[model samples]
Target chain A: MDNYIEIIGFIAAVLTTAAFLPQVYKTWKTKDVSALSLPMLLMFFIGVLGWLIYGVLIDSPSMIFANAITLVSSFLLVYYKIKYQK
Target chain B: MDNYIEIIGFIAAVLTTAAFLPQVYKTWKTKDVSALSLPMLLMFFIGVLGWLIYGVLIDSPSMIFANAITLVSSFLLVYYKIKYQK
Candidate 1:
């Protein structure tokens, strides 16, 4: 069961982390952050940042890895939104 | 450090889970699931479901709570996409 848990955790981390990739790709490809909502992005960025901090504190590598990548991807979207959005 | 971690986890949970709300609301209100990509939503839904299973295995309330709400929101979006989209 414990092993199963770890496997699930790993799977969860990989999938969720990967889920953001398309949005990241779309944002990168089009350079169009207009469709993205500012408030929503801000909330997500902050949320991921918090998750990163939590992972660091918990000493959970899965959380750390997932949140770190998510943070970067989300942060990029926020940056693009600010830079490009009119 | 531990206390800080818990706080961060809570914060993370609140924000990320909340992040999905606007999309849920928008989908509910506009009934415009057309803009939403089916593949992306499916990926996200599976990811969140995996996360929820991981949370259950780990006995982490924060992860459980966050993913549970997210699962519902994402699932709703998926349902709407299939139901309303042309």
Candidate 2:
């Protein structure tokens, strides 16, 4: 069913979006960024922003929602990486 | 244009997926995963896998492609984290 497929997409969106929380929490708590690549975080933030724009273009609410959350989370990681870099 | 929108999605996919390369390379060269969180890696892997499946269901090539590359990259991160952890 179409609804079922949409549900799957929603679940996938949630999974991928929520997956970043642990990293954000860990980084916030420990501020250990030695292994966290700054370039990677920057690129991911830009990329997810792109996804958000694309989602808006496509008018997919799930994609928009997922990418928005991911954008914020990746941005936090980037901020922490820069702030905590030794 | 629809084509342009699709192009944006492709670009976003490429950036998000390719973003992992730097981290992978750094980890490979340094084998320093102290900042890498195992829970994050595991959750991201599962999430990306879910995205891959949803992409298939949605018949989105870009989603499938992006998630596939990300899945492998994240898996490698997990592998390195476990293998190199001190």
Candidate 3:
């Protein structure tokens, strides 16, 4: 059961992390941040930080791995929001 | 400690869940989703489903609680993406 749960966690991690790919690509291509919410980006960055801490606590590599990528992506999103805010 | 870990999870949950507020608000006001990615939303929904399953398996109320809100929000995001694709 635990193994299955971990497998689910890994798959979840991949899906969630991969989901950001298209967003990043679109943003990179369009360079539009108007529809993107600045506060939401910041909030998500902090949220992912909390998740990272929780992952560290639980010693779950999948959680840590997923949140790490998310954190980086959130940071880039925030950076994009700030840098390209019109 | 498990208690502390749970606290972190809760905080993460709140942060991640609440991050959607501004997006929801802006989308409701403008009804624009050009910046939103449909494929991303679908991937997120699946990811959250996995998370929800993992949450149930682990019996982590915080995980379950957080992912449930995210799942609903992602669905709405998807709905918005499909409904308002101009």
Candidate 4:
């Protein structure tokens, strides 16, 4: 049961982490982020950092992997925000 | 140092977890989800569920709290998506 649950965690981690990629791609292609919020992205970046700490504390690979990717995406979103501001 | 790190985790958890509120509020008020991605919200929901499981396995309150709140918000986003489709 634990293994099954762990697998679920991993699957979820991948899905959530990969989800950010498309948005980045969209922004790169369209360069339209009029709907995106700067404060939200900032908060998200900080939050991902927190999750990184939590992932380290718990030593969870899923957490680390997901947050690592998310951190990069959110960081880029900050730059995108400045570049593509409406 | 460990305690300090844990505090950082908790703080991150709160910021990330609470960050969704404004979007939800904006949607509630404006009924706008044109900028929001349905697939992204769905992926986020599943990922948060995974985090919840990971939190349980590791006995981490911050993880649980953050994921729990995020799960609720994402679930509502799904509903909001259905209701406010562009």
Runs in model 2 deviating more than 4 A are A82-86, B33-39, B81-86
For model 4, residues A1-86, the per-residue Cα lDDT tens digits are 66776687688789878767888888888899887888888998899988887787767777787888889888888899998896
The stretch of ten residues in a row with the least summed lDDT in candidate 1 chain A is A54-63
Candidate 1 structure quality by residue, lDDT tens digits, A12-49: 88888887888899889899887789998999999999
Candidate 3 at residue A40, lDDT? 80
Candidate 3 chain A: 10-residue stretch with minimal lDDT: A20-29
- Model 4: lDDT of residue A68: 89
Residue pairs in clash, model 4: none
Regions of candidate 4 where Cα sits further than 4 Å from its true position: A1-5
Give the least accurate 10-residue stretch of model 1 chain B, judged by summed lDDT: B1-10
lDDT of 3 at A37: 83
- What lDDT does the true structure give each of the candidates? 0.85, 0.84, 0.86, 0.83
Docking class of 4: medium
Candidates, ranked, DockQ: 3, 1, 4, 2
Candidate 2 C-alpha lDDT tens digits along A1-57:
777766776777887777777778888999998868887788889999989998788
True contacts kept of each: 0.90, 0.75, 0.94, 0.79
DockQ of 3: 0.84
Q: Who wins the DockQ comparison?
A: 3
After TM-score superposition, what is the CA distance of residue A25 in candidate 3 from its true location, in Å?
2.8
Higher-DockQ candidate of 1 and 4:
1
Task: Report the TM-score of chain B alone for all candidates.
Answer: 0.91, 0.91, 0.90, 0.87
